[model samples]
Target: MNKFILIAAVFLLTGCPGPMDPVPQEYPAQARLVDNKVCITVPARAGDKIFSVQFGTESGREIYKTFGQPDQQLPVVQGQCLPTFDFQFKPGERYAAYYKLTNPHTGPGKLFAARFSLEKSENGHLQLKQYSRSEY
Candidate 1:
């Protein structure tokens, strides 16, 4: 027991390495209006996981915040999942969505931020949200 304790203490005394440049409270994501649903598809790496996602108003109001972050369980899954958020928007107006990605195994991962705009059709139907990945 004493030897085990000693080894544990030594490990703790050493510095711990943490993930660098983690995603902030918010991210930069975009969505496009398609068939009455807003969709944003980001390619996933092997073993990658989705930590959190949200749809916020241009004024900073969060309409959708998923607590149980989604994860990609299959290691061989090579493509991205199209996470769609159904929304009602006005044409000629814009909105933003945010998403976070991580490595569930390591708890350390990279973040991708993106944005998009909504285009109003002639019939007043809102469609197409577009944006670029940048600092959230």
Candidate 2:
């Protein structure tokens, strides 16, 4: 009886393994500006929807921002899912694009701090110039 009481007391003190350690957060998708367009890709088929897209240019060209959520997943090209946001860019300038994943199943629906940039090509068209993801 004493042993049973001691074991019960220990179990009470420790507390049942901490509520399953919280469901691991999942990130939905990522994007990059390629060929004057936003190219996005998800780790799984479920995270194909892009909730919001915002852009900034070196010239501060009017600050473009828009929201899009396709009823179905966009077509995959080169294994990367592309969103429908138009990439109207200012020529001969550098710009950054920010993205956020919307679908709940995908991890936290937060805007990734990574910025995708575009630069004017020699031919005077916006092309994928750089990509940066935030460590924080």
Model 2 lDDT per residue over 1-136, tens place: 9999999999889875667766434343455555556565555345435556556665675344445545532323335645536656544555555555565565555453334455667787666544443411
lDDT string, candidate 1, 1-136, tens digits: 9999999898679755447644355433435545755656555566765565556656554555444534432222333334534545444555665556666666665454456566767896766746554522
Off by over 4 Å in 1: 1-30, 64-81, 84-92, 105-107, 123-125, 133-136
**How do the predictions measure up, each by TM-score?**
0.53, 0.46
Worst lDDT run of 10 residues, candidate 1, spans 72-81
lDDT of each: 0.55, 0.53
Model 2 TM-score, all chains together: 0.46
Number of the top-ranking candidate, with lDDT as the measure? 1
**RMSD (Å) per prediction:** 9.6, 10.0
- Give the total clashing residue pairs for model 1: 10
Best TM-score among the predictions, by candidate number = 1
